[model samples]
Target: MDKAFLIQFTGSMAAVAVLVGLAAWARIGRPSPGLDEARARDLLAEDFPDRQIDQLWIAREGRGALARSGACALVLIQVGDGYAARRLSWCQASSAMFRNGQLDIRLGEVAAPRAVLAFDNWPPKDLAA
Candidate 1:
């Protein structure tokens, strides 16, 4: 193979690798068995000790959860090997809706919101709804 061709092939391969990495990073863990409301509250309780959890719902697939604590809505996602959560409040430009058995809550700007909580077959009243 020509040296130039090898260089181009290597560059293309690198680009592909980077794209794959980004795609993987964009998604969290696969659905699991521990997304129930009790589990969600227990998880949040570690961080939000005094606040009351008004509501919570685990996605049908168990990949994500959403909850209302005090004045803010907490969104928890399975990230990496553990979990990650974000708080969205009415103070920000947050909006929520339940469509087709999925609850979608978006906070802040239209681009991506400070946090986006989308739960499949979510239960309870959504904070923004």
Candidate 2:
């Protein structure tokens, strides 16, 4: 093969490889357990039996340096019929586990709120609160 042609071919391959690597990295940087509204509601129902979930939101927060960052999906659970409100945070890893029916919520920091009676679902009962 001609030297110029070989160099050009190698350069093109390198560019394609870089592009593919970037795409994969971006995907891995995203948080897991990307649940839709219906699935989120079902998970909440199983965790918090009686309370009706009003809304659920998956919040992704990036941590660490930009090059090595990781994302976490925060499940915000909200509940209530009227003016009352409560909130709970089911961390990304925990939410994924629970969504899979593993039930591994660390109730210590992210549990039922005493003042507002929050439920354990995505967008916990009093999310707005």
Candidate 3:
């Protein structure tokens, strides 16, 4: 490639990097909101209109939640700057472990295979719903 072309390309790349860095510093993307019961309910309502949440548990830091709807369980987890929700039977879980006040669950999902939820208590009363 020509020297002038290389110089221009390098300058353009540097400019893009600077913009990305600034965006990151400013937190341009929507970070996960602290999920309260109402917020979680709203999100669940929007996602699963047919089901009604009978019981709900939010992670200590609002990182995730576990909700019981009818006979199934719903999981809401933070992914990147957003959240992902999944409804499944607890029996479908590949594994579950309690570590340092957090419960790690493997849901066997390709997009969101695992969720780490923190609660004040370990060995949650209801691991299955």
lDDT of 2 at 120: 41
lDDT (Cα, tens digit) per residue for candidate 1, span 42-114: 8878767777877666667676776777678777777655667666784342345667766556645454453
Q: Which candidate is the best by lDDT?
A: 3
Candidate 3 lDDT tens digits, 1-129:
999999999999999999999988887675657999999898888889999887889999997788877667789998777778988875442246877888888778787878889988754677543
The lDDT per prediction is: 0.66, 0.39, 0.81
Off by over 4 Å in 2: 32-129
Model 1 Cα shift for residue 123 (angstroms): 8.7
The estimated TM-scores of all candidates read 0.52, 0.27, 0.71
Candidate 1, position 38, lDDT? 74
Model 3 — TM-score against the truth?
0.71
- Looking at candidate 1, what is the lDDT of residue 26? 78
Candidate closer to the true structure by lDDT (higher is better), 2 or 3: 3
Model 1 per-residue lDDT at 27 = 82
On the 0 to 100 scale, the lDDT of residue 102 in model 3 is: 82
Query: lDDT (0-100) at residue 98 of candidate 2?
Result: 40
Candidate with maximal TM-score = 3
